[model samples]
Target: MSKQFFVTFCLLFITFYGKCQVTCSLPNKKAFETKIDSLNKIDLDSLNPSQKITSIAETFLGEPYMEKTLDIDIKKETVVINFTGFDCTTFVENMIALTKLYTGDQNEKYRTLEHYASILEHIRYRNGKLKGYTSRLHYFTDWVRNNQAKGIVKDITVEIGGQTYDKNIDFMSTHITAYDQLVKNDSAISAIRLIEDDLNQTPLSQIYIKDISKVESKIQSGDIIALVCNVKGLDVAHVGLALRKEDGRIYLLHASQSKGKVVITDKPLAEWLKNSKLNTGITVARLN
Candidate 1:
């Protein structure tokens, strides 16, 4: 879509769903717009969707890894989009939202921070509607599933020989106190329990760490990579974009909590997988 059409979509979306929206407050909102405007000035019309996403993600390489970038006041559950900082998941989330704005149907444009907010609401919520805390796509697997269902991405794990494993999700509700929003909201807690129950009824899959090396060449840049964990209740512990360097090696471009900033992994994909004992494997989703 073009810039004019994107602005139209944002206006229409807000007008249609204003009641369910949360107040978006960003201190550097204008600066972000300037940044995006500058990015738009680049000759990216010839690039594919994945290339656009990769280029966008690379721009934030040195951004600090601020934990809880999404957590706002407990009473307001807005779709938070912060360029000032990012966690691993938000890093992928923003890149995907920006990619959609750049390449979505040729007529789309994000003219303001609210436009980005609308894009994020669609990307981060169930059925693209921000109803409440429960509507947030908290789990990476659920995020993949919802976005894929909306035709935003496609799960390519099975095509790459991923094997099905028992699903064991429930971390959010079980550890309710850890989340500020979920602690006082009983309704939110109940909704999460339902989501967890549904997740438990299904089988999930991933490409085992042992097998990532075998298909490393098939991995492409801008592909969303979820680092699966061996933890009892979680499907993924971290996420990032697959960045293929000129040396023909695929490294992870992610927000490193350890380093307190975003950085591309020094080790290659397989070697990096070996570095984390908690990393059981990986699940990949390609943006459409």
Candidate 2:
């Protein structure tokens, strides 16, 4: 057999039979592959979706919190995946993506880093396609809405007695410097304005900090927790996952920008919110 044909045959062979782990080599593949390999080292076959997510999140408790980990300096936007460090949004999204990939039949096609990238593309982008800098879900509210609409998660905030909160979300367009991609791209800024305008008109709901105690029992492990803020021009201030500890209390497992590390909050969920001056309330999205 010719050398080139031999290599192609091996690649084709693995595509069909390699169903044990994510092995596709892509940009930042080492970090991404390490995460998948860690999860695969154990038999996660018995855990449910929520359990699977929390289980994986707990393994990264002390990982350093890195801001703008996905900030690409390129002229064109690309899907950036890094597991070594995480911001609040990436941490929650990573856990969600891992949970989705970890569950289901092992024989299914989630056996490569490329598959995880595909899953992240769907969860991170609007309508599951990366268009440009503007296509990413910059706001947690919009993130929840898009992912929920895709049946990846269900918004359970209102069902748990969350109250309506009137607010406008245009922070990304207004503060372009916060995102490197928007700084030079006027088109990206304009596109974000349209998204912000739509979100401004939409009514948002959240569990008031005072009411969180009432719905504390309803919040489950692995649920996406977005802290709704009272800040003008912004919706959620931070994002995390709910970690219901063995003692029956829910805590925030998140990439803490404040502490610069991933941590499960020392205080209970409700108490943590009550003490948070910037956080006014929270919106919950349960994994489907």
Candidate 3:
């Protein structure tokens, strides 16, 4: 996607939310802590992680993409530049970095550079060469499911964003910034975060999808489906995870600029089905 398209998408994405589908809530810090504690003891192999992850992910329900830069607690470490880097995809990068640190990996200082890494490379490193960055692959759902299959991370549900999510259902979301929409208006104060991947650059060909079958099999609860709009180049717009599937319609939750804020909705992929190019792209991949 060109810089022109990127900015345009960002501008229009939030406007989509102005249409207003359903109202969502954010969990308080107290609720967040209680839910995460539950994840510490679950036998990940026996159950799904969506609800568990969703519980906490929702705490950031309405956060902006740039607030992550300002929210980190750095313990008064010579504040030079307090950047507001709140974005859904980057938030996921931060979470992955923290998880790696939790695993106690000696390489990359565990929490330092890993948080900023791109989704493809992160998955490739975690899953290795066999899963070399899949270009057409878009959204965190695809990556999380892949990791779950390899046992790199497990899912569990906890309270977040004032809503209870089944960890199994959590896998279907993207990260967004949580800030004061009124005061911050365009900003949020972040405590010097230790996470933020320098490598998690957005790909032009990436887009969000609700149906996994469009690109792969099973649009499972936690898969991040990418709806590719890049008929000519790389994917341009990406929402969050493909979380809910209902009434034969797949629903997703993400920090959409299209909605001008964080939102949950269904029917995007269904709408795309009418496009001829999309129909062909999906078919070609199946044959390949």
- Which candidate's TM-score is highest? 1
Structure candidate 2, residue pairs in collision: 22-112
Residue-level lDDT of model 2, residues 203-252, one tens digit each, is 99999899998898999999989998878789989999998888899999
Model 1: per-residue Cα lDDT over 137-198, one tens digit each: 99888889889999999989988778888967988988989898888888889999898888
How high a TM-score does candidate 1 get? 0.89
- Candidate 2: what lDDT? 0.81
TM-scores of all predicted structures: 0.89, 0.87, 0.37
Query: Which window of 10 residues has the lowest lDDT sum in candidate 2?
Result: 13-22
lDDT of 3 by residue, 56-83 (tens): 3445456554433322322211111111
Ranking by TM-score: 1, 2, 3
Angstrom error of the Cα, residue 196, model 1: value is: 0.9
Question: lDDT (0-100) at residue 178 of candidate 2?
Answer: 75
**What TM-score would you give candidate 2 relative to the actual structure?**
0.87
The alpha-carbon deviation from the true structure for residue 135 of candidate 1, after best TM-score superposition, in angstroms, is: 0.5
RMSD of each: 6.8, 6.6, 17.3
List the global CA lDDT of all models.
0.81, 0.81, 0.34
